[model samples]
Structures are given as structure tokens and as C-alpha cells.
Target: MLQIGLDAGGTSTRATVVTTDGECVGYARSSGGNPISSGKIGASSAILDAIESALTRANATLSDVSVIVAAMAGGSADDSRDWLIEPLADRDFTGTVAWESDLLATYFSGTFSSFGYAIVSGTGAAVIRVEDGQIARTSDGLGWLLGDAGSGFWIGHNVALAVMSDIDGRGPSTALTPRLLEALGISTEGARVQGRSPALPRLITALYDMRPVQLAQFAPLAFSEPEDAVSRGILESAGSLLAHSVEAVHTENGPLVIGGSVLAQTGRLAETFAARLAAQGIEPAIVRVADGAVGSAVLALREAGVDITASVFRRVTDSVARMR
Candidate 1:
């Protein structure tokens, strides 16, 4: 039997087909939009295209697939499961499907041996806690408007604020403002003003990239010297918010796993996060997921009837390594 796993992230949708033994058969990816904004029909079409591409790569048909598991941003326990069930029920695909938050899928796939916390920091940030094989608590997955601290959105938002302050002469004159202006090839503050007018939110988007951290170098800007104070403050705040999320669900002791592009690429944030957590007397095992997409695939297999054994874990890990 084959298991199909899909990870629907903020920027793209990824799908993978893996065998019961944990060998990856095929994988495909394509751009996808937020279902909450685009409507279910639009979201489903994008996901279906990705799934079809993956199965075609494996030289397999949907009929040959026995199970499906999807991990999506903004996907809930019920709505996520319905994507496959409702679609497959019409005979377009054939599978047993389950839906879960991407964080839960990643958490269950890794750290299966112990209770722990998982923090995902990418376009956004969210905290998940697993206890005795169940989700014990969660926090701040509310997206850009409400939560998602220490995320790309957060960094970008703060950078914008800092620049505005500098423009008004109310904030410290940092290297970021000039550096950003130069990067954008704008010679004067007038250009920045023009970009922010009611008609130009899109043009103003690049204004946030002035800070090194905002540039997503995640490293040199956050760790190296000559960094602006506002950038440092942003990093510290993000890490601290992540640490606080962990503490909210943590007991006296448990493992803490950090996942996503931001954490995986930047060691500075991890170090800062560890130090902050330690202040609360909690030391966490900070590790990046070798492959979150494949982790979702393993979750699909486990849900399909594979036993969670030492050998099974090794097989899943090996498959992810080979594919990633």
C-alpha cells in the first residue's frame, strides 16, 4: 500500500508518496494560497494538482494509494481531514485520510519516545505540546494579526516601525534606515513616503528588508556585530516569545524541538532561545527537523497501519534523508 502526505505551507504545497516500508516513491510541489481567504474550492484545486503531480511521478495512480494525510497551515482537526474524504468520496481519489495541524504531524513523527514541545517558526510561529502521547496544550498560532511572534511577519513588521520612527526623527538613527534606502535604490525619504501612500502597499513591501535580519540572512545580521539595535531587539523578542510559548505548556521537564526555516537556518535564535528557557529553569533539546514534509509522510504511514517500532522509526528517518 502507498501513503500520500501533503504539507500545505504558507507559500507552497508539497506532496509525497511513500510505501508502507517507508521508501519515498514520488514527490511534487506547487504554489498554494490560503484556504481561509481563497475559499475551499480554490484551495482544493491547488492541493489536487500537487497530489496528481506526485502520484504521476511515482508512476502510480490514486487507486493504488491506500491512505492520505495532510498537514496544512490553518488546517484544523476536522476541516483538514475533510479535504481528502470529501474529494475521494466522489471517486476522484481512493484513500483513508486524516488531517492534522502541521505542528502535530511533525511532533508525532519525531520525539516519539518522549513527551515534549515543538515550536514552528517560519512565515509565522506556533507552539505545540505533546504529553503521554496526546496534545496537552497549544499557543499563538493565530497568524500575523494576533500571534506569530518572532516570525518573518513579525521581523518585517518591526523593521517597518523602526524605519518610520527614524524617518520622524523620533528613534535612534540606525544603520538600517540608510542601508535599506540604499538597497532599494531610493535617494530620499520622499520615495519612502510615496510608497506608503494608500495606493502603494505593494511597493512599500521591500521597505521592510532594510535590516539584515529582515533580509533573512538570519545569521550575519542576528549574530555578527555591527548589527542595529532594533534588529537585535526583534530577534530577542521573537526568541523570548517562543520561549514563553514553550514555558506555557512545559511541565517540570520535557524535550523541546524547534522546527521551520527560521530556526533551522539560524543558530543564533536557537542559542538565544535556550538561554531564555534556561532562565525559567527549563533546558530544551533544540533540534531542527531533518524533513518536516517527509515527517508528515511517516505520520501518514503510521495512521495507515504501520507499527511505531524502533525499526520503523529508522526506516522513516532513512526515507526522509534519502528524499530530502
Candidate 2:
């Protein structure tokens, strides 16, 4: 029987159909289907489209699949779970279904262990504790507006705030101001009251127009000159926050799994994260996941009655490598 795994993000959704023996039969991608990011109807539609596309590519139908595992973002557990389940049930699917956070899938895909702490530091940041393929608890990942304390957005947002502070003479001088202004392409437009107003107001307006993802582009700026005080402070704060986010979960000692651009990249942040976790008596295995899609597939295999032997895990890892 075929098994399906899905990774649903704010930007897109990917579906992979694999046989019980870990042979990849089909794979397809479609538009974003994250219910928290995309509205319910929109997310549901995209998810359905992606699944159907994968099945078609495999010369199969949903009925042929024995189980489906979905890793998704931007929806409550119960609500997002229904986003896929209710729709697939409508399509006459009668297989086992597992719904969980995309973070959990990433953690599973990154390592062979069944229990651990997975922390993500992309545009947003979060800590998830996984126990036997189920989420025990979580912290952070509240998005840019609310929390995401140690994420890329947090870094970039703080840099912007620092720039404004410097401009207003409320903070010490930093090299990031001119660099950021240039990156954002904020030029000296005609001033309010015929050039009487200072340039800071327009800069604030410019920052407003840019979206969260757009702002996230500047995250790497903090690492450009790691020795700079502002960059050092930001990175250190981020690392400390991440350490605390995981510590709050209090999971039994397991490999600390790290994901996302900030934590995965070779930089001061990653270094500091290791140190901070060590302070808590936690060490990490350093599994860098390029994409969490394959982990979803591995989970689907588990639900399809495949025994998770060491050899089986190897096969799952091998399938991901071959597909890549």
C-alpha cells in the first residue's frame, strides 16, 4: 500500500507518496496551505490540490494509500487537523491520518531518535518537545507580531529599532544604520514642510511598507560583522532566548535538534546556542534539515504499519537522500 506525507508551509505545500518499502512513488508541490497563514478555505484548497497532484503523478488514488501524515504551520492543533482530515474524508479517503506541527516533523526528520527538543530559528522561532511521535509541549513561534523572541524577524526588527534610536540620538552610534538604509533603498525623498522634518520619519514609513518576510532578509546582516557590539548583543540575546525556550519545556535529556537559518548557519549565534544549551546540561546532535518534507514521509510510514527498526530508519533516510 502507498503512504502519503505532506509538509504545508505558508508559502507552499509538498506531498510525497512512498511505498511501504520506502520507495518514493510520487511527489508534487502546490501553493501555500498553512491555515494560520492562509485562510481556512484557501489553505484547504491548496492542500487538496497538492495531494491529488502527488497521487496522480504516482498513477494512484487516495484510496490506495494506507496512511497520511501532515506537518503543517499557522493553525491551532485541532483546527488545522480538521483542515486536512475533513477535506480528505470528503474525497472518500479511509486511511490513518496523523496531524502535527511542522516543527515536530522537522525534528523527527533531523534525527533517528523518538524523543528530544527541536528548536527552530527561521523567520520565527519555537521549541517543540516530541515524545514517541507526539508533541508533549511547545514554546514561542507566536509569529513576528507577538513573540518569535529569538527568530530572524526578532533580529531584524531589533536592528531596525536600533537604527531609529541612533538617528534620534537616543542610542549609541552603530555601523548598521547606513548599511540597512542602503539595503532597503530608502532614499531622501522630498521632506514634509519643505525639508523641515528630519529623515527619521520617512524611514519609519519605509520600514512599515516592508512585509515580515521582507524584513527577515536582513537577518544575515547581524552576522556580517560578528564583532560589532550591536550584532554581538543581538546574537547573544537570541541564543539565550533559544536556550530558555527549550529549558522551559523540561524534556528528558535527548539530542537538542536545531533548525532554521539563524541556528543552522555557521555563526556566533550557533556557537552561543551550543554554549547556552551546555549550561543546561544539554548537548545537541546538530542535525541540519534542508527541508522537513521527508520527515513527514517517515511519519506516514510509521502509521502505515511499517516497523521502525534501525534498518527501517536507514531506509527512510535513504529514501530522502535518493529523492533529494
Which structure among the candidates has the greatest TM-score?
2
Residue-level lDDT of model 1, residues 69-154, one tens digit each, is 87776765445555446876776665677776778666755665547888887767888888765567888877777878777667
Measured against the true structure, the TM-scores of the candidates, in listed sequence, are 0.82, 0.88
Scored by lDDT, model 2 comes in at 0.79
Off by over 4 Å in 1: 37-42, 77-91, 183-185, 189-226
List ranges where model 2 is wrong by over 4 Å.
77-91, 188-197, 211-214
List of clashing residue pairs for candidate 2 = 36-74
How accurate locally, in lDDT, is each candidate?
Answer: 0.68, 0.79
Query: Local error of candidate 2 at 248, Å?
Result: 2.3
State the lDDT of candidate 2 residue by residue for 181-291, as single tens digits. Answer: 788776545655543335677787888888865677778778785888887888888888888888889656877667778887777787777788788887756677765
Give the Cα-based TM-score of candidate 2 against the true structure.
0.88
- How accurate locally is residue 24 in candidate 1, as Cα lDDT from 0 to 100? 82
